[model samples]
Target: MNSLIEDVSPIAVDVYRSRRERVLAQLRAQGGGLAVLSTAPEVMRNRDTDYPFRHDSYFYYLTGFSEPEATLVLNASARDGEPASILFCREKNVERETWEGFRYGPEAAAEAFGFDAAFAIGALDDHMPRLLADQPALFYALGTSAELDAKVRGWIDAVRAQSRSGVRAPTRAQHLLPIIDEMRMVKDAHEIAIMRRAASISAEAHRGAMHACRPGMREYELEAELLYTFRRHGAQAPAYGSIVATGANACVLHYPAGNATMRDGDLVLIDAACELDGYASDITRTFPASGRFTPAQRELYDIVLAAQSAAIDATRAGVSFDALHQAALEVLSQGLLDTGILDKAKFGGVENVIAERAYARFYMHRTGHWLGMDVHDAGEYREADGPRDEQGARPWRTLVAGNVLTIEPGLYVRAAEDVPERYWNTGIRIEDDALVTPGGCELLTREVPVAADEIEALMRESISH
Candidate 1:
């Protein structure tokens, strides 16, 4: 059988090789250190059953090795003729393979993954001391895992014990995340391609849910539609828990228990997306369960839609992430004032409402967040004094080409004396995956209808057929 036929899609072997080379170059720049990374350990979902295992983001970013109990080591400055990239993974066991699944073992793992060498995980303890010796620095996910931390300390102690000889252990230890996280923030061509497909698949799932929705159906039924669409289109799983919220449940941000019965005249907010390969696509669409929105529901939905539109327009290169949030907030605040949700007499004006954050009563969350491999993904919002502001704090990082983020602007109106009674229990959020481009940004999750008319039309068409 051809090896290429069995390898994972979206990430080619050359992509993994280039990622390791990039990290190695950075490590060499930091004085030729030896860097170590480990995959996430398997965890139990219940008494005996194990939850599905996912590889660590940082580790997979470089090695593209998905197996658990694996570690990668990069010797940036290797001795002449020695390979710089090494992998330590589980040794193949015939019985275990029969019980659990296939094992690549070391030899095939190294060749398939483009590693310089590979060893059984059992040899990690024996190899660590030698790998740490005579290096200028040792780099790993410092303070992340106590077990890994203790293992590093043991290796260092072993190297120190050989002080009588000329051998030397690394004196400095650095955190490997900061260096690698910056690399993960920017999506490459391959990553963007995978994300685009993920986004398209997720968008179709949302459309499916919209078409399948009915007033008498349970929220979980809509969630089932999403899951079915996701799996049918080759998605691994939901990027996060599917949020199938109707009526008051939509007001709760992170509403995971989707068991409520959807009612007529209730607006359902479906905040769900799928994970394709290792990338994530996040999308949220709120529409009427009864195929037509009430007058109050349309009023609030249009406001939230306008805010999202403003935010999406502001999502361009060179603008700070905070700027997009502010743009969305401004639109939302003005909409509140226009719709009589906020009294200008008591809340002052639109500017005063935003300045005082009076809009928090209706619009609470930030406009968006970085979206990629891990959903929330890796990347810094701020850096050390890179750019200063009037308040003497570092400003949010500016958007750059290749940065993919979510533009989510939401509004939730709970019953209050100041709030209109008709708008009570109305919650709506419009979110889409956006990629920064040279001109502006591309909307990755735009296939689904967001406009009230379009959503109702789509639902009507589905019902008619």
Candidate 2:
């Protein structure tokens, strides 16, 4: 019979192998330990309808297995000499596949995903204790997947009960996050490749939106064009919700309504997103609904563009993640002062008195976030002391080669009686996915038009053609 699961891409397969080796090395460094990991379970949004199933980000990072209810166990012991990773996945069920979809059972999972050992899901309870029998430390996220957490607790408890027969269970059960997150921070070649592709698709999607958007069109209609570009170009789906904001609707951050009418002279802030092969790309761009910016709109747009450029420049090896945010804030804060939105005399010391607070009213969100399997990707950035310490911090320690992230800086001004009349109903955001490298940072979405002139030319080209 023909297999429904398309052959896993080489890039995805390589990612799985690299992550496994990393976990093994970490376990070996720990002087021998075992870690149990599981993908998130399918969640129900309503009867017979399931919220899109996304594998646990961590699990997906390590195994590249998108299937739900799967478990991965790393068995490492000083006594055994080396560590091995075993994957447990759904067994062949023809009837179930006929109903829901096809699944790669253990044998197929082993061959396709490059696991050292493979077992059926039904064997987890029977096999887990045996794997953990004498491990001295357990590595796993304790409270994440409740059902899997309970199952893991039961398995550990059983192993603990056998403490009498010289079979000592893990004396310490540390959270798996830090160990795994360290590996995820510096993406390997394969991950970078996938992210580059994701960014390309995302950039194309944003360009599509910019070209299709018109003054009288509904925001959702613009969103539809973006999605069409995503699927047509082989993106799995949006990395996050598509934010299509027009007019005053742009003032509402996290606005997903996307149903408002885009009026002439308004800037359409499309935070269009896309993902490919599980690697994520988040991009945002503001376009003039009339195909050309007004004097006031151009002023704010150039400020944001400059801020975004400064922020991207700040992404480099050894530069603190906070540095980029601060750089962006400096640009935005001063822009506000220059535009008369902020009174320099009254707020003269605001930027100095408060770090990042002076611009918080207008720029509410963080300058950027880690981009990976999830959009607001996981991995802790700050240390326990709230400082950047690579040794102690997993993800946000420092920008390193191979790490992919977004630098998005935005300004939103809602309509108000006292507010500057010209600034009302204006929202501007510019975002780009960057890859930190040894020499400098590479802008992944550079192919997409960003400069005001470039964007206008692209829009004009589309209209003329």
Candidate 3:
């Protein structure tokens, strides 16, 4: 490992501490138990080729350990004051290394990831029963891996066997989600730094796509440009599938069939976002295939931009998490009414339409979501009763300082005989990564040109020179 990469940032340490507190708190509440977590397994690309390995989201969130076929066990009753964080990993083999690549093995894994103890994966069955003996309950995401599930059940059954000796096994098994996800909801400085960098890089990619868009270019060609830009700027990978929809195709959300050739008089909507070291940045920008937007396109684009502005304003501290979507929906609904695209009566009243979900036909998806390690960063905004858990009286949790989310406001009009001619076949979305701060919201994507006139000006500047 490079010395530079090995020196984990203070933020990373902070994130680790936060995660530990969450897991330990749960373990203590349960009165001493063993919590087991596993990394994602590598899947095959073809007959023998294996796809590039990526750690499981929850596992990475807690341990920040990126290796494959590794399991983390937290022993709550360890003699040490602190709960034991143990990892079982592959042992280094010279022969295997010669054929494949470097393996972290047990020693390196423990030291690098700050685990209390480490052992070879081969010793799991032997170690598990002894460690889990008489524990109160088991903590793990069961059924995530069939093999792991079977192994865990077998180990628990062995513990159950002790009933004849008056040794009772744990009758409870708690899913690790509630505790882990709650920990992930709030971003520490370290996670925020990575996410900010990712947003900057993703913004650059969107800018590149904006400048590269021109008549006769295939949508996939433009997508290639955006992806190359992301990699060049050092994002780990695209947070989600890149959508390079041109003209009417933009109406199709999640459109990844990027084969359409851009035309002179069409709008190109590029919904491409990326993840940096796992922290995600999602952004959507719609621009004209030609350098400048047509009059109707500009009108609709401005409405979406205005809606996004409202959404950003709604992201202040102590504001409802859904306030932004409501604000943006108001702008969108008004714009549709002004453009005569929707019947105010048919859509169940403009303002009421949003509450009743009448605008879903065109909007299709939520205005935005929490952006972090996972694109739809793990954590629930609502409780089982579908109400805010805490944080204030807006019927939704208030936006806090460390919350980073996307403020994406879009309006898609599909081509149909009944649709107004002026608004036909136009899909417009303007998205920016907004960071909720103590004072207010800061637009992390301020660099990527977004003002209607600014986008056109940048396009002109790029092409004319």
Top candidate when judged by TM-score against the true structure: 1
- Judged by whole-model lDDT over C-alpha atoms, candidate 1 comes out at 0.90
A best-first ranking of the candidates according to their lDDT comes to 1, 2, 3
Question: Clashing residue pairs in candidate 1, if any?
Answer: none
Q: Residue pairs in steric clash, candidate 2?
A: none
lDDT of 1 by residue, 143-248 (tens): 9999999999999999999989998999899999988889988899989999999999999999999999999999899999999999999998999999999999
Error (Å) of candidate 3 at residue 221 is 0.9
lDDT of 3 by residue, 183-255 (tens): 7777887787888888888888888888777799999998898889889988778888999999899998888
TM-score of predicted model 3?
0.93
- True lDDT of residue 198, candidate 1: 97
Question: How big is the positional error of residue 206 in model 1, measured in Å on the Cα after superposition?
Answer: 0.5
- Candidate 2 segments whose C-alpha is farther than 4 A from its true place: 1-6, 9-14, 78-83, 163-166, 349-356, 383-396
TM-score on alpha carbons, each prediction: 0.97, 0.92, 0.93
Scored against the true structure, residue 41 in model 2 reaches a CA lDDT of: 79
* Backbone N/Cα/C clashes per model: 0, 0, 0
Residue 41 accuracy (lDDT) in model 3:
87
The sequence of per-residue lDDT tens digits that candidate 2 reaches over residues 25-59 is 88878877888888887899999899988788888
lDDT of 3 at 359: 70
Ranking by TM-score: 1, 3, 2
